[model samples]
Target chain A: MADFFNIIFSVDFGYAVLRVTTPILFAAMGALISDKAGVINIALEGMMLISALTGVIMSALSHSAGLGLLGAVIVGALVGMVLAYFALNLKTDVILAAIAINLIAMGGTVFVLFMVGGDKGISSSLASKVLPRIDIPLIRSIPVLGPILSGHNILTYLAFLSVWVMYIFIYRTPLGLRIRAVGENADAADSVGISVRKIQYTALILSGALAGFGGAYMSMGYVSWFSKNMTAGRGFIALAAEAMGGATPHGAMFTSLLFGMFDALSNSLQTLRVPAEFIQMIPYLATVIGLVIYAANKTEQIKRIQAHQNREARKGAQEVKLL
Target chain B: MFKQKRLFELVRTVLAVLIALIVALVTILFASDEPGRALSLFLFGPLDSLRHFGNVLEMMIPLLFTGLAVSIMFSAAQFNLGAEGAFFLGGITATSVAINQSLLPVVHPVLSILAGGLTGALFCGIPALLKVKWNASELVSSLMFNYVALFLGLYLINYYMRDVDAGAMVSFKLADTSKLIRIIPKTRVHFGLILAALTVVAGYYFMYRTRWGYRIRLTGLNSSFARYSGIQTASVIILSQVLGGFIAGSGGAIEILGMYRRFSWQSLPGYGWDGIIVAILARNNPALIPVGAFFLAYLRIGADLMARSSDVQSEVVYIIQGVMIVLIAAESFLAHYRHKLVYREARKTAASGK
Candidate 1:
């Protein structure tokens, strides 16, 4: 127990938290955007998986991390557009379309990997380039905080920076308001000349791009190589975080940090006497618990609002009777 | 008129399959050194021998169970994805029961299967309970629960059932009494196929003939209307999900006992996701689930054969599955043709009446 606390308080753990949180934060923000636009992109998992491999292959081939990132984002956005075309234009169920996308990504990645890497599981043979890490000069000189916050992967900083960008984009922009309007009531938005389909398309594309960054960070920054299903359940966990955060960027970042803490702890605990499988279960278990709590709170708030409305209606009736 | 509609649906499904196969051919051409050989093997390999055909039948059993499970759950509009978890947990539970040395001869497998099924029901019941009581999204909750089930099952197997001398992370050999009897002489096809068929018939009866089924159908069609009609839509939702889980669980147990000598699954078996494909292909009809399952099993076996015989990977089957699903589920895929047929049929009906 004392050792556990020691590990938790160490600068390494804090840095690990930030490191692990990068992909999830990006994914949650992506989920938040599409969710706010009323077309939840459940294909974030598949998109991330596809982009992760794309980043590895492109970076290996081009010898440029930036080009790889660009390729990943482009592929991700293209996938989003395909999903949009199927869901919006062909009138397919969005969830089912997302499921199909996931299946394709699962199989397609392995197929392509074997074709390119000559291996079925991992891209060890490919010489993929890793994204550069940045050191904050001033922060690096500081004490405990410096070690925890400075000298991280560039994508880690971008993951944190994106929260602010998403906040401004979602809450303070005209396009954001239009997305909210479309989400709140598509018919009302349509009547006012807002094209719901176009908004959803834009949102899904942006969402996929964000997830693409997460995927690239996974293969290029976090591990330096691509593996089968390496994104694992992070995309789903991001969806849960987005939900718990009430579909807001900042809220999602915080919830993502919380999940990241559990993830880091799970990683650290593997060195101890704990069963690795049980420790690995913590993040996923937390997600389910977090979702239930969020749902309960939402239901409670709705009931309270309904009760207040009933009281106001009775008061209005009483006033009419008196008159 | 109904027949016309059914005909159009069949046509659309056939067209979707053709398009999906074309996609597969293109993918093979790009990936395989010998595309023609790969394509021929993928199209005809499963029919080449009795053993390969038997593999298809063996694969069909689990798919049938999951397809029926998904069909029931989707029919009630409950998108519970816990069938995957339930299936995994059910296998574990059945293994736990099957390894028991004290069970009677004939009744052991039956008891193990029933226990496994009940375990699945309880496993899936968590998300349903959450959705009913707290208005949680069953889809998200079930997805999370799948991992929970996975880790918990692993822990159980590791601590309680691990056979250290077996040289891998597998459970002890199941008791002889608990092993399902082989039904075929030359193949691994066991009594599970019969069980699967009975399950399909039972599932069809339960979904189409019962009052509960009617309620579930109504709720799925329109929950608001079902609620207005006092159908207790919440319980109906939970009931449908639980039933689906039960069927999925039974399928997992049967697959294990009839197929393997020991419980050796190290990850989610993915039958649940395949269930979604099967259910979609069947249009969520219980009666048609077998046909859908058989189609998927046949495709999978062909892909497996192609992978063995050619340079192309079997994962191409997933591409085919994904494309087929998208095209079939698209409401507007062949809308122009469908509209034309409906219009022509309407005109003919009017002329005939005159």
Candidate 2:
């Protein structure tokens, strides 16, 4: 217990939480946007895996992290477009299509990795460029907080900033309103002159780009090399976080931080005598528990609403009886 | 009209397969340095010999079970994808039973297989219970449970079943008498194939001939209507998922017993996901699952052979699988032709009525 406290209370642990949260934060944001726009992009896992490979390969070739990011985003958007075409136009089941995309990404990445003369499991031969870390100017002067707040990958700050940006975009922008409108009721949105399909396509493309950043960060910001299946269900965790946050940017940030804390704890626990598998199971178990609680609360709230309506109806019946 | 609809389904399946093949070939043409050699091997490798044919048959065993499992769940509208975890856990649990040398020789494998199926049913029942009680989405919950099951399974193996003398992370090998005897002399083909075939027939009969099966179909097609019609939709849904889980779990046990001497899998074997694809291609019909499974196994073995003999990567099969699933699942891909055919049939029916 003392060792646990020491690990949790340290400044290094704080930094680890922030660092680990970056990928999940980006994915949750992406999931939030697409889910709000009426499409649940379960293909986020595949998108992230593909982009991780793309970002590594591009960075290796061009020696520019920026170019690598651009390539990843483009590839992600192309995948999103494919999903939209199949689901919206061809009338395919969205979930099935996403699964296919994921399978393709998983296999395609390995195929390309081998073709590029790299190990199927790891892309260590490539000298991939990593995103630069930035030290916050004013915050670095502080003693205890400096290390925690400063010297993070630039993309980490961008991930936090995106929450604010997403807030403004979702609430203040007309396009965001249209997207929400379509999500709530597509026929209603169409009646009001908004093209539901077009809005959904746009939402998916944007969502893909956000997820691409998350993927790129896994390879370029978190590590300078790509590994096969490195995402390791982070995409699904992000979706869970999004659901936990009620598909809002602010809520997603908080939930992502919670999951990030669990992840960091898991990492810390690895040094202890505890078996690693149980620690690794923490985040996934948390998701299941959290979702169950949320669903229970929702059910309770619905029941309460029904009971109140019943009481109101009884009261009206009694008044009529008195008359 | 029913005949025409069946014809349309067949055509769509053929078209989807052809498109996937063309796309896979084109991918090879671009990626492979020795495109000619790779393409030829990929196309004809699985059919090269009897041994190759046996390889496909061996691969089909696990898929057959998982396909039937997924087909049952899909027909009941459960969408519980925990079969992956069920398969893994089933194998592990059965391994625990099999490694015990004290059990009766004849009943050891049977008991182990039963334990696996029960464990799988229990694992899959969590999501079903959640859905029944709280109305939670099974897809997400079941997916999350898979990871939990994985970690638990690993912990079980590492703590209780670890064989330190064997390779790292390996379990103790099952007793020789407990292992399933291979049916074929040279090949890995075992008595499990007969069991798998029987499972498909049993599954088909259970879903189509029984009153409970009728209720399950009704619930799947229209749960609200079924509920209104006093079908007890919740129980039907829950029961089907439990049954599906059992089928998948047994498949895992059978595969391990018939093939490996020990539980050697490090992660989910992916037969669960492949089951989904097979289920889709089979149109959720148990009778067709074997055919779909065989076709998939053929493609996979062909890809493996190509990878071994040439410059082509086996991952190319994923590209084909992904493309094929999307195209096949796209219900409206041949909408124009389907509509025209239906129109012609409807006109003829109208004339007959007149």
lDDT for model 2? 0.90
lDDT of 1 by residue, B1-354 (tens): 899899899999999999999999999999999999999999999898889999999999999999998999999888888889988998999999998888988899999899889988888788989999998888888998899889999999999999999999999899999988889888899999999999999998988999999999999999999999899998998899889999999889998889988899999999999999999999999998998999999999999999998999999999999999999999999999989998999999899999
RMSD of each: 1.0, 1.4
**Per-residue alpha-carbon lDDT of candidate 2 for residues B48-141, written as tens digits (9 for 90 to 100):** 8878888899999999999999889888888788989888898989899988998887799899899999988988888999988987778889
Candidate 1 docks with a DockQ of 0.87
lDDT of 2 by residue, A157-266 (tens): 99999999999999999999999999999999999999999999999888888889999999999988899889888888888889878788998999999999998999
Model 1 misplacement above 4 A = B352-354
Q: What is the two-chain DockQ of model 2? A: 0.82
Candidate 1 Cα deviation (angstroms), residue B111: 1.0
Residue lDDT tens for model 1, A151-257:
99999999999999989987899999999898889999999999999999999999899999999999999999999889988999999999998888888999999
Q: Give the 10-residue window scoring lowest on summed lDDT in candidate 1 chain B.
A: B115-124
